[model samples]
Target: MATYRPRVLIGNWKEDACLEEERLRDFMHKRERGELLIQKIDKLQDNLLKKIKLSVTKDGFVHFGDTVMLLNPDNKSSVENNPGECSRLTLAVNLDDISIHSAISLQAPCGVSATKSVEPMARNTFCILSVDGGAVDEPIRFGQNFCLGTTGGFSDQMLYLASDHKSFIRSAKKSYLQQVFLTDKLSYLTCWRATFLDPQLRLEYEGFPVPANSKIIITHCHTNRGLAVPGNFWVRSYFGKEYEVVCHTYLDSHRAEEDKNYWVIVTANPSNENGTMLDRPSPYPGETTKNEFHEET
Candidate 1:
């Protein structure tokens, strides 16, 4: 009598490592998807903005919704690493928001990176709303994008503005590998685009004075996480007027008791004639310098 048996094949070290990496990625993607679904449900169930409130403390901290974010001032060492002081602001959010099952906590720090892990807390939830840049007086057409899932742990939610009461649609995911593996520059740009460029929504301080027919580009150094602090924004007006705006968030030491966060905006000369200058020199060869603006925060 002859018996036939099949032997189990074992994966080699490289194969096993690849498998482990894939599994980790799958787990992260699934978690992000679940969080997004919960956010959508929350949005449908309640008006997030109504439930939440935002205010700056007398000292300098930001009171977002029910959470109070404590801003820690950056030291000289940290400032040297960035273009300006307070380049890297440490924000501590009150955990109360998590208890109410609210999604506002997840979205407030949309593009900013968390310095540490908080138990039972999900990453920030973000959405992008793009609107026609026509005359300010004219009616604007808008679109949105929200985070669905990410490829290699890097994804930006782009949301379109809907006409309904709950006016955001999670339309697509924009993936930038550098953001996931290299730096947070892309994330900062994503937030900037949603906040400053979107004509439908305006941020505090009347947003960044973006002019019509002008293009705004965000540039920064390669940082592993958080914003490319002391980020740069190149704004080129229609009439060939170019301006550089420096954006940085910092904890005001003088107002430390108030626990406030501040964003300093300074305009400077352009780095090149074309008004496009990167934080680091161009990586590609044959690049030439042009008229540009340099802003300090």
Candidate 2:
């Protein structure tokens, strides 16, 4: 048998070994941080996913967990007595399993799931819930009651009065509620009245003539909270430049009362001309722009 010579170790084998060991350690440290961050985010998301439901009403009261809070006619100074409890009731929306935090900032990857692809979709539905009050707007307050009218996505666009069973009846006299209003292109104006007729709730939008083929959509409405009316109006100037105006109206029950109907107007004009200069058809004979107040039960 031939004798075998022992192999010699390469130069700087010790240095190479140390360098390799350092690289491995660095990778492990980074991995540990990443795991920890993921764990934190998971806990936070799980806690916020608990179900919270609200029953729509004309008085603007909503259920916060099991507690009922009023939106209108508020008298409470704080939503909750305990600061921690108040902090826990903050509202937030999560759409398509993506964290709001991640959606708002793309740099941070902590809350995103590895299996989920980051791509935009045509339509997305969001889940709304209460979370830590760190980022959301402070709960709206009226009197001593917490106003869920503008909170919890209960604005006019999502809620509306029932059209059947005479939920709303016209006032005795014709006034702003029956008048036709004019607005400039790129500008929006709206007004509304909210009334509760015992078991029924009524919401009336000030009437205006819309152009042919224009669309009318109710943006939000609530018997107990607020109302939102959004519609599109198309216009063509004397020079033939086409323009569009968007109008939105809201009536908050928590703020609206008998003889004090809620109203809001938005105006935007591409021509930069004063509102009076915009050409609009004259109001019908005997119609008045002034609002007529009436007492409601």
lDDT of 2 at 14: 65
Residues 1-297, model 2: lDDT tens digits: 213222324666666667668988987885677444455455344433333232222222212221221111111222233222221111112222233324222111111001111111111111112222312322211111211111223222211111111114521011212211111111111222222321122233222221111112222122222221111111232112211211123333633332111221111122333221112343554663333222232
Candidate 1 lDDT score relative to the true structure: 0.25
Deviating ranges (above 4 Å) for candidate 1: 1-122, 131-292, 295-297
What's model 2's lDDT at 230?
16
lDDT of 2: 0.23
- In candidate 1, where is summed lDDT lowest over 10 consecutive residues? 144-153
**Residue 5, candidate 2: alpha-carbon lDDT:** 22
Off by over 4 Å in 2: 1-20, 26-37, 50-142, 145-297
Candidate 1 lDDT over 1-297, as tens digits, reads 213222324435555567668988987885787555465446433432222211212322111121211122232334444454333232211112332355432332222222221111122112112222233222111111111111111134322111101113321112111221112223323322212222223334243332211122221222211222222221222112121212222323332211112221111113432221212254555752221111221
TM per prediction: 0.20, 0.21
Worst 10 residues of 2 by lDDT: 111-120
